[model samples]
Target: MSSKEVDVQQVLNTVGEPTRFRIIELLSSRPHAVGEVATALGALQPQITKHLQALEAAGVIRVHRLGRRRVARLDRETLARVAAYLGGLARADEDDAALDDYQRAIAREETRLAEGDSTRVLRFERDLPADARSVWEAWTNPARAAQWWAPRHFSVRVFDFEPRAGASIRIVLAEGDAEYESRGHVERVGAGRLVFSLAPVDPAGEPLFEARHDLVVTGEDRAHVRLDIEISAVREDAAPAVAGLRPGWEQLLDALDAFLRTTP
Candidate 1:
């Protein structure tokens, strides 16, 4: 029979049971009658017999008449097919490490969350299609920055974004009918590096948290960018923003990556 023809889910569901798993383990060594299995497990014959019937119906085991008694053994074909299916999942895929990092960050933040005034650090790295100069320009240039600074489905309004030290910065991102205003200033700017801080307020004009961002861009032809961000002064009302930090940054990076690919 073909691989697709195997009832892998049924077999898995049947063997997933604790008692049935032990029964399969017992049968793996050799064929066992219901009474013998019951004796080995210290279980009643009726319970063992019922389990055997389920295993057989699910193609996890095969039962046959042996000397006026039923004997059960592992159905090797069905199990081997399941093993093959599981083995296929071990193959590698692109961006898997990024996905794993995001998952780990989520777990770590969940464990570290507390009541008030919490702080969180986020690190993000990406290799882009554009050169370091172009990438830096995209950040420093107000028009270029406006094109890609916001996440998907959001519009950006930049009040001011001067790259020099102590330059005041203000930008607002809007989604649907709501807007989040980011008010801060550029702290330092040098060759392919920028340090800035943003204190974003929610739609209701309530202060959430202040995020300090340190960004570095390097390489030629292909740029490698790193962002180290510290989110601090978290308020009680900003828990939802903290929870969505990873996914939200992922979307913004996605927007940047897309913008770089299409730009000169």
Candidate 2:
């Protein structure tokens, strides 16, 4: 009856098909066009299209027009919703059994990326059920930003934050006993968008790699905002760092959504 409640049987039935499950695995890293999906699955275009459409209709995959191409990407929030439901039911046996399958699915994408399929830039776009102003405040305000800037399992400490062009922005990301300091300067700052250059530093304060993060927020309607996050300037050798950027940011965005949902 609620947005978060999903038909468990429906999810099980939809993912039961081997082809659909494989399609979901293929999209774990990045979005794929219909042709790309066909090539990845070695199936005919029409067949893959039908599978994708089914997944899209089931809310597991989202199909959107990116420029002239229709691309399908995993709807992580929807997946997370279902995962939360399953976890709440205390399905430990099923969860334990799924660990291996999940790892294998992720390994397929990692293999592809390792074999010279490195991406120069990582991009993500999501529509949040929050206003642009709230989203902007959550990003620019130091305390709010600290709440969700790091990945789900990590925490962030904002040492120096000035959300203005040419101002300093420094943060320490802590995961357990390990910590990394990132230093950067804000390049451009506006009402709904912000751009900055960031780099991780060693103990000696030497830069690891130069990177840039650009975020744009668009007011979609009275109660929704579309946010675009892009990371670039990733060095070739540092490809591994950005490799997990997609899922890293996805979890952070989920954190942001949770923050907003509770705060509102």
Candidate 3:
């Protein structure tokens, strides 16, 4: 093979076995004859020989005739290649921001899941550089909400919304030619708080689950927001939606934060 490349996975599989790893570790000190290696590890000669043959096939080691006995030594170049391959994988993860987001969601995991095993509760908090009044408008006003209502990769069209007890709420989120509808009503809306229930419908026009949102905004010159979401009435086919709820809301909140900062 090329000097710059090696079958690292094959070498891993070969050395991954316990006995093979022990044999390689034994040889690392210096080349050893087959019988000497078996004697060092207290393993049978035939078993050690079989492991040595697999390692040889994977280019992890080389066996040579030393006078009358056969001796095996590690191939330094192949082992170096495996180290570089693993280093590259570690660097790739360092550049991924989504991994940080997932870590944040995991940190917020509840002490105990809902008793019924059919409901999930999620909580999130963000501090935004805007007053509570304007942040409230961003959520309730269609003209303002349209700017940052949907998550990434979706555009929202607000058809109806009334900020009062028992008023109707409806919005359509479109991703290219595909459209989704969310319908519900306000439980209460006042000052800097909104309590509402929303159900995002599926393709067959069935509600996925009932999500009750208790969003509260505080602080004067700058807003401190807290949101508690409880999801229930989960339908059988709502698996994907349930899994995505935390990430989806994370994106939406980020969008709102950006929109409010840049708005006139």
Candidate 4:
């Protein structure tokens, strides 16, 4: 086998072990000395050092001398090259089956988890010269909504939208080839408040996940909107979804503020 092939196999074999996987996970966060990693893993320092040396040989990790201690960290560049190679292989018919199987196994594991309710609420108050009707029109209007929906790194496309009760809205966000859809029926529409349920839709327009949004115009010349977003599947997973949503909601509120400021 070629040297590159040998290195690839070596990396796969080393990381296939549970202990080595843990070591990589730790090193990915920050560089660690052999002794520190050993202590963290409750293993002998010698065993940790051996694994580190093997990882280094496989080009999966890099070691730097830190005075008396040697610090090790993940070699991200090397890993990126490995990932690119894997993606190329995945495009091949023979390798696609293995990738499909791995994905199916992950999906099965995710499905087995008990469902829970994970809801995040964000409220914002903003002043605008536009009346409630105008504001509502700006929000539900495709052209106006796209102008400020995602201020950074996202573009919105609305195919269908109506602001009245029992009407549905569909919006697609584009970032590269990655597309996300939000669709739902308008549940309530008051003098200044509009409540709706939004669920992500697949490419075929099937609901992927559901969330609720409540926009209340708490004061005239100003409006207060609160979005109550709940994802059943992600609620069960908890950690990642919770961590991601906290900042995400804050950013969305910021986007709304920008939108209100720009809208007449």
Backbone clashes under 3 angstroms, per model: 0, 0, 0, 0
Model 2 scores worst on lDDT over the 10 consecutive residues at 222-231
- TM-score, per-candidate, Cα-based: 0.56, 0.53, 0.57, 0.47
Which consecutive 10 residues in model 3 have the weakest lDDT in total?
107-116
lDDT to native, each model:
0.82, 0.74, 0.82, 0.67
Q: What ranges in model 4 sit over 4 Å off?
A: 1-134, 230-246
| Candidate 3 TM-score versus the reference | 0.57
Model 1 lDDT per residue over 35-105, tens place: 89999999999999899999989888898887889888888888888988888887676457656766675
Candidate 1 residues lying further than 4 Å off, grouped into runs, are 1-117, 203-206
Give the per-residue lDDT digits (tens) of candidate 4, residues 1-264. Answer: 233644666778888888889999998889998888999999999898888888888888989987987989998877777777788777757335544755564454355443333333444455554556667766766677667675356677555767788997776777778877777888887666678877666667766545677776544455545455544444343343234343445555667666776755
User: What's the candidate order when arranged by decreasing lDDT?
Assistant: 1, 3, 2, 4
Candidate with more favorable, higher TM-score: 1 or 4:
1
Estimate, for each residue in 126-161, the C-alpha lDDT of model 3 and write its tens digit. Answer: 999799888888888878888888887788865577
Error of 4 at 69 (Å): 40
Find the candidate with the highest TM-score and give its number. Answer: 3
- List model 2 lDDT by residue over 1-264, tens digit each: 355455666776787799999998899989999899999889999999898888877788889987988899998877877888778888566445444655554565457556755334556677776788888888888878887788755788555788889998788988888997888899898967788877777787765556678788886453344434344433444444455455666777888888888885
**Model 2 TM-score relative to the real fold:** 0.53
lDDT winner between candidates 1 and 4: 1
